[model samples]
Target: MSSDLWSFSLSTYAQPGVEPACLQLQSAGINVCLLLCGLWLGERGVAFNEHRLQQLRSVAEPWDAEVVRPLRALRVNWKVVAADDGELNALREQVKALELEAERHLLVRLERTALSWPQGEATDLSAWLNGVAAGAAHLDRDALHQLRVAVTGT
Candidate 1:
């Protein structure tokens, strides 16, 4: 497994049900980038703390809110029109790629945020997931658990 958050998120997201689970979490106002960063840190044995959690959130929230989501919304919205317009469909595809790139950049930013933080503390993946999900008002517990198992085999 790659130590970088982008690679980690890419691979984890390929696992079954992870995408829908992520969207479910995101719809509840959770920052998926931060959630993935929390998982990456947990896998790397970084200790969980409120300060660093907030640090990651501070860096990620705006990017996800302002850039990634809009690109995503536009792309998703184009599904109807794209089904009929070839040019529009091509543009939508480009938007989808751009949206992915945006998320990758956000993940990189998150990784950078944690770069200065010390490691060597073991944090449970489940606990980390819960902590990240704490701010989400409508999170589905089963989906979260399923996503956990899909990624961590736990």
Candidate 2:
């Protein structure tokens, strides 16, 4: 797996079951970008410190709420008419690309925030997710485990 956040996210999301799992988590109002970052950190063996996580959240939350979420919503909304309207479908695909680019920017922001942290101690994937999610009840444990397994190749 690629070590960088952007590459790791792309590769992981491409894994079987991971896209649906991520969408499931996203539909439940959890931040998929943060979740992806957490997985990347865990994979890279970053220190997983609380301060680092807080920094990540602070950098990500507002942008995610204001920017990424809107693009995602717009794209998802288009699905209703995308099948019938070719023009709308094309627009929706453009929105999808914008949403992905927005996520890439978020990952870049996250990468910058965690740049100083040492990848010294390997952390358990589940523990890392739990920390980043702060025990969000909406998250699906089974899907999360599947994602973890997919990313870890275990």
Candidate 3:
């Protein structure tokens, strides 16, 4: 695993909650391919990086695009909330759940993507391990274990 990537992901999780965590992960080089898919599904005006989308498309299968598009759109829309305090907390919880679901789906997609890797591209196992190491620093052992299982299908 790349220590640089591991440190990056770990730093992101050290933040408050899911959105900040997601933002941090993005900053730290988490796959924005799904985020790009979200953009294709009408998630414009959110300031996603175009180069990241191109990287995602490079590794993605044609069918995977269809699968990820709606999921990414759902993730984009799920982050919206009203102004009420009570409603805001509820929205936060819902967003957290959605983020977790998105991460799970990303894990599956990454696993599939790993299978078709080119000669020098890093393996999914290394990436998963890096994510796990990062997650372990912030999440509980149980949550870390769950993430491991999600990523590795074990």
Candidate closest to the true structure, highest lDDT: 1
Models sorted by lDDT, best on top = 1, 2, 3
Model 1 / residue 80 / CA error / Å: 0.9
lDDT of each: 0.85, 0.84, 0.40
After superposition, which runs of candidate 2 have C-alpha atoms over 4 Å from their true positions? none
Model 2 lDDT tens row, 1-154: 5968899888899899999988787777678889889888888887676887789899999999899989988998889889899999999999999998999999999988887778858767666787776757676777778778888877
Can you tell me which runs of candidate 1 are displaced by over 4 Å? none
Q: Model 2, residue 150: displacement in angstroms?
A: 1.2
Better of 1 and 3 by lDDT: 1
Summing lDDT over every window of 10 consecutive residues in candidate 3, give the lowest-scoring window: 39-48
Summed backbone clashes in each candidate are 0, 0, 0
Tens digit of lDDT per residue, candidate 3, span 63-142? Answer: 34555445555646545543445666576667667655655465445335433333333323333334323422243434
Please identify which of the two predictions, 2 or 3, would achieve the higher TM-score against the true structure: 2
Better of 2 and 3 by lDDT: 2
**What's the distance in Å from true for residue 127, model 1?**
2.9
Show model 3 residue runs off by greater than 4 Å: 2-83, 116-154
